[model samples]
Target: QPVTEEPSALAPPAAKPKSAVFYRHLRLDFPAIVRGEGSYLILDDGRRILDASGGAAVACIGHSDARVGEAIMSQIKSASYCATLLYTSTVCEQLCRLLVDSTNGQMARAYIVCSGSEAMEASLKLARQYFLEKTQPEPQRTHFIARHQSYHGNTLGALAVGGHKSRRLPYEPILSTNVSHVSPCYAYRGKKAGESDAEYVVRLADELDAEFQRVGPEKVCAFVAEPVVGGALGAVPSVPGYFKAIQAVCRKYGALFICDEVMCGMGRTGSLHAWQQEEGVFPDIQTYGKCLGGGYQPIAGILASHEIIDTISKGSGAFVTGHTYQGHPVSCAAALAVQHIVAEENLLANVSELGPYLGELLTKRLGDHPYVGDIRGRGFFWGIELVEDKATARPFPPKANVAMEIIDLGLKGADYSVALYPGSGTADGVSGDHVILAPMFNASRAEIETIAD
Candidate 1:
């Protein structure tokens, strides 16, 4: 029942997709989402679809959150926007305070913005300024190390550092040449046949070290990576001791470790930050988005540790970057409210409790399916890899479009609507394929069961 753009003989009965206005199919034909309640999105025609992917895993508290709405409305009633440069609003200050408290003061500052890409950009600029202010201004220290098959953002700078070859291909001629990529710690694909977990972690750490050394240790500013691989590689978690080892290497070379938790952080992985869940590992700089504002008003920001901020404050008095919409009041207040409700209701507790059961249910429902190759994730984030053969883990050719097929069936025939967050080249940035599913944090067990089944 999966609809393909290709011509096929055995297609199911359905309305033809209507013409889109903005872009092509890969560009648009997405339904006009009319309204949402709980985990369900009502389309313009009134078809209720389960929001399994939570609109790119952004709506953590789900739609119809009265508290978040009320908080935003209250802020709007007074003032909707306030430029952080001249006037500092109480909402922005309180939000920063909350974020700092969440990290137990290890985080010294938060730079808020209107989108995830903006947050990532601010993080990079902030890191650059931090070193300059400290008088360690090594202009050559502009290089960064990232992993393959990972997605950070769409802006040229962030996209340049990202590993998704397909997304970066068109912009290669113009992308910054300061980035070098190493292998991601995708155990299912990157692990050797006879190697132990410790060995694999060491290998990846060693790769990072070599990259830093190749780029010149003094020139490498930071190593950026997602704590748990999202987007491009599905919901892959690194091997045990992976982040610790990587952190050690980065520290040995005096490079900052920037964790891009735009997808996996903010209670999506049972902990407020995914890096917090890792043993003896925390990032020097961190970026969060998506659930930070629960997809309410488009908000995100960078959190810097006290060490980084002190170095900057003592060195330079002002950040070099400028954005008119940075630290907009309504977005910050909405995010604060979402964070508050998440705490007051103890929704993270549910994410932890329901996550394991959902995993089990997924395995129970699809374990025996011939095409399912790998099922992996943590907390509410999950991914299913489909292959031509499960034993060999050989993915279907792009021409076959296995993920699209399964997703189409899951959406239409299954009487459920879900966003198909799949990745091509999940194995090596070119070949492996997978579908990611991240349900809302406040989702009911029964609703989760229905969605899973």
Candidate 2:
């Protein structure tokens, strides 16, 4: 009998090895990054792509910082992992203390986590727990009120509270029904033709109030919002008095105020906390990530106000949630180092000083572009909104993928070698396009100019 060859032996080799990693976009091929040098990402093909958006506004100090690497190594040599429930590491304590101090003691406690989504999930649970732990417990307070076009996180609880239409579409069936959304404080479109800022804010506040009443104010646990809307609305900041009015509504309804500053916090907006710029808008519970660890390690956290902490302290003395890596020592060490660098170098001041010039450069360059409908942002975080018709402020249809196309082109170095963050559904929940530019906190004037150019 003739020897039979196995089918595998007869087959030819594949053109490329199959990737074990699951990519966000399955069909698209991604560039392999070799290393990061300052603000540029060196690709395997030898191209240098400027990290203009800081990889979704996370790399505050840019990449490849020797200080962060040293801190990580030091932490690993000492203590790499610790069961947060059983023991707390010094680095974790120091990082938490630094966070609380940054808020001038307004935020009384910090709960560390691995990502913004985890931090947001904790915030939701803690808010609900706060009501349960109150002197006169309001167990009925199970509802949450969030703004339309806002994004908190992708977890089930976070997704329920977030009002981004596209993101919630697939998960709507499983999302909790206890959350409802009102219009966002998007003055660009929400503001009527001749409406003043104060009037727009009042209208928004009234809408929020009506939603609370509809949901039954006593049943609402908290009202969640981003200080300056990121991702979903493309860095849209509330008009003056917007947060004050909305927060007043939350107070009136006896609901806690939760500010999700994952993208806009950690000096990204030229302030230690985004709420610092919004007068009289202190949050009862705030979630922060992105720049927290400066992309040096996976870390995010929730800063709870004294009232919430006191109630929980008096009631159970424990937050009823835990993650296997909640207070990972290595992550905390990296974040601590990143935060110290920001403070030592006065990066927040740099953001403030160069922020206006960056804005000016963006406006001057793209303000007259036919597709450029709006240019708005604060500090190093800015967005350029693209439109189909400038006069009508009409967005290109979602299928067009205008923002993604521009970003892809930039990454491919067709026109410019820069990476930008893209946002869709700006006009409604499915039609507009905008690109975000969140440069590193330590970005120099020349770097900002290159980004804008």
Among all candidates shown, the one with the greatest lDDT? 2
Give candidate 1 regions above 4 Å deviation. Answer: 1-28, 135-138, 418-420, 426-431
- For each candidate, the alpha-carbon lDDT, in order, equals 0.82, 0.88
Candidate topping TM-score: 2
- Model 1 TM-score, all chains together: 0.92
Model 1: number of backbone collisions = 4
Count clashing residue pairs per candidate: 4, 0
Cα lDDT tens digits, model 1, 331-387, are 998999999989999999999999989899999998888888888899999988877
TM-score of 2: 0.95
TM-score for each predicted model, relative to the true structure: 0.92, 0.95
Query: In candidate 1, what residue range of length 10 has the lowest lDDT sum?
Result: 1-10
